[model samples]
Target: MGVFTAADEERQRGVRRMKTIATGALALMATVFVLAKWAQSAGAGSWTGYVAAAAEAGMVGALADWFAVTALFRHPMGLPIPHTAIIPTKKDQLGRSLGDFVGENFLSGEVVRSRLSAVGIGSRLGAWLAEPDHAERVTAELATALRGALAVLRDSDVQAVVGEAITRRADAQEIAPGLGTMLEKVVADGGHRRIVDLVCVRAAEWLEVHSDSVMDAVTGGAPGWTPRFVDRKVGERVYRELLRFVTEMRDMPDHPARGAVDRFLSDFAHDLQTGQETRERVERLKREVLGRGEVQDLIASAWNAVRTMIVAAAEDERSELRVRARAALLSLGARMAADGRLQGKVDGWVEGAAVYVVTTYRDEITSLITETVAGWDAEHTSKKIEAHIGRDLQFIRINGTVVGSLAGLAIYTVARFFGV
Candidate 1:
């Protein structure tokens, strides 16, 4: 009772009623055969002989059909006859055959593609998504998915992965040639002039403020034999020359010192591009910068910032990221719904993806069916199947009884006409 569904119970009752009717028919035939034989023996009529023959055939047919039907589920009359209990004994084989049939026919790539293509999934999806409410639902679902994904990720693992990727990329690419090209472009465009002017101005200001320090440095480097006043005068002259040169460079754009600074930059840029020594020096500097603990920390922290930004955007309905995503989806949906070419492309993609999945996992799918069947108890399975189709099978028995009687009557009538 626990195993049977309510519908199955109803079917079982119907089966029992049919079985009773079939058995009654068989019993009726047996009684008729007995009466007809008795009458014939008493020389009642030739019709009694025919009736006995028909009744006898009906009984034989009914018993044969009853055994055939019962043999499918269990042994008839509890006898362990060979080939009886077919379903229970051969359940595993049947399951395997069913699985193989499905795998070969339904799960094939061609079948999957054909079925999905006929469904027009892409066009239907586009039509559904074209609606504002549907678009909003999709947008919300996407946001939730994004949030869930970010939440599941460990920050430290993400940080480490980001750091390693950045480091590896940087290590693989040589920066000197690229840097030189940029420098050359800047110099050609006179972008370096402002930088030079700023430096010159800053130097002039520093020299003006530390004139005493400059004089002392010059005098300290003088020969000890020189008079202190001469050394002091020399120091003053040196300091004045340096200050005047910086002032000229700062004020005059066409000054010789400015021209010299430009020439120096031009030469350095050229060396960066073509000189091996210059490139090697740049490479060394690059390695040093990349190898620093502070740079690694900066790279790792970038992932944290990006993760935070994305999570915030996903959480906020009004955020630009979500708003734009929703808008874009709506637009795409509308376009796809309107454009046939796009619809075709989308359909093709979907079909190809579906076909790939089915082809790749067909074995697994079939195994699931087969294994589930194999796990069922054989006797239980037999009973379950019987509950479903046992009522219909009773019709076969009923038909056999009626057909057998008619056939017997036809044969007897032919025999009497032939005078047999």
Candidate 2:
């Protein structure tokens, strides 16, 4: 379909009206010229000669203007006139010229910067975004974009990337030193006492419940020559002492057993930090854990869970993520609107970006114009252009006839007065 709209149709009608008016004027001029010539020959007033000259000149002007206007679009009177049909024949050249003109004038970096700076995009944007409704609208659009991006991503691919990244980072950085430092702090602060207490309590409870099993195991390990009753008594005694020790450790926070356990952990922590062998062992264990099928699956599944959570948050308008985003946007807009420095920075950034695009891509932009015009049918292009501007051109013809007639009359009168 043609690109011409209702506006174009209205313009075309205007052009037709102007054409009729101009043609009628020309016809009137010709009729006047004939009548005036006849009157002059029949010894009518001297003014008749002036009228004849004016009418003749008016006809000439109208015809000349009509030819000039018509030549821009098509051949005059269907004659194969050279340099006629200017638009249709030279459409490509005209397009290139137009493209060059735009490139030189409008697409220049200075022009772009000047225009954009005057527009004050930053101030307008800030005011618009400062509104609560506007902020909310922007937040909704951002959420939609985020959801779309997430949906477009493949879970498998993201999971692989995430897993690989984590693996690489972990492999690159040794966790042993950090872990050792943490352990040292925990031990020094008696943080490990709670865990020690738990173990002691659990041990005491188990010993109390499994006393008979513990005794039977001790009795079974006794010499064969010993009496079963004596072995049983010895086993009972061993179980009693074991239970007592555990109960004391559980009741006393500063028990020797707890102190010994702390010392052992402190030494291990120090070894982990200072010993290369210990660090190597820890690293190897880490690699092993990471290499496990279950761990790998866990890592991969973590991405899916995160993606789902993010998508859900994005979809919900009342979600913290959306609410926070809206709040952030509102705050930023307010700051930008109120703070001249921020506004200046924003304006500068915008102007710089615009200038960059204009300077860097101007050739491409101009080429797009040239290419589009080149692609259009030459005859169709001519008609389309004429439809837009033919009405204005017709005014030129009308003005030509009127002005020419006045000039002719003045000249003829002056000639008669001077006896020329």
Candidate 3:
């Protein structure tokens, strides 16, 4: 059988047992009354008459209670008795009342606060989080959640956001002053000397490789009427001077030509950072560079590479990102377990968050209970409730029967003592 069906059958058996006990109690009381009355009619002792009276009263009380309880659940003996079968007949109204009762009493803001405070939620959270294993579990779950969120974001959406951000930033800020200031610092710190050296070396190598071309260019610039020999001689002299100048720049760190070039660059750097005309020129150059299609393509390519790397990292189990995430989790767990101050801080955070939610959305949350109850089929709701609580209520009937009988006997004895 299904689980629910088995539970229902169990509930039904309980209900039947309760009814049987109640009926049996009433029948026994009635039997006592009948026996007592017979003894009184046969001229038995006054004690027998008193006993009959008490039993008779007890029987009435028991029967009355039985009828009252039976009427709540069903019509007695299947007869159309007024006000009987109260639950089945007025189930809808009962459901609404129950819903309203729960909403007002159990779901109210004050009730929730009182209940939570009584439970010592903050301390409980602190105690739970103080465990290393619990903290590690929480951290792992958080990492998984972050990974899922990252995975859900589309590449196109990210690319658009990145592109717009870059464009906006570029449009809002002047890049030249920043660039110039950085260059000025690099120059002052001798950071640019290595670059200068590299340039000199490359130039010397190029001149050595293209000596013939250099000679041709120098001679070609000469007048057409000049003798070929004279042109060749002049070209050779010019080529040799150019090659010697490059070789000196490359080999001699303190060459006069090198010092002049360095001084010129230092002055230019200062002007780029501070001079108005120089700044304006730098700004113009920046605008021109940023306006180029190549610059835009480079920015887009950077975003693409970053996005691809992130996606790959998110997908890979052995990724540095994931490894760091796991290690962070374990470390957090260790800290939470060892440090009481940290545990308290975490607990406070949790309490604050929970209190905020309860204060802000309490009304809506409470209303859900009422709304759910109102939406339920009343008969089904009543049955469900009865299934849970009816067995317990049966005990009330049993106690009443036993107590009423004892009380009746005591009253009868008191009345006899008073000679009533």
Candidate with the larger TM-score of 1 and 3: 1
Per-residue lDDT, model 2, residue 171, is 96
Alpha-carbon deviation at 11 in model 3, angstroms: 3.6
Per-residue CA lDDT of model 2 for 1-420, tens digit only, reads: 167789888888999999999999999999999999999889998889989999988998999999999999999999989999999999889889999999999999899889989988888888989999999999999999999999899888888888899999999999999999999999999898888888888999999999999999999999999999999999999999999999999998788988899899999899889989999999999999998989889987888888889999999999999999999999999988888888889999999998999899999999998998889998878878999899999999999999989988888889999999
Candidate 3 lDDT (Cα, 0 to 1): 0.74
Model 3 agreement with the true structure over 278-391: per-residue lDDT tens digits: 878777786777677787677768867876776677566678876676666656656665677776676656556666776677567656655665666655755666666777
**TM-score, cand. 1 vs. native:** 0.73
Top-TM-score candidate index: 2
Model 3 lDDT at residue 92: 58
Worst 10 residues of 3 by lDDT: 121-130
* Backbone clash count for every predicted candidate, in the order shown: 0, 0, 0
Residue 29 in model 2: shift from native, Å?
Answer: 2.6
Clashes of 3: 0
Candidate 1 segments exceeding 4 Å error: 1-73, 201-245, 376-420
Top candidate, metric lDDT: 2
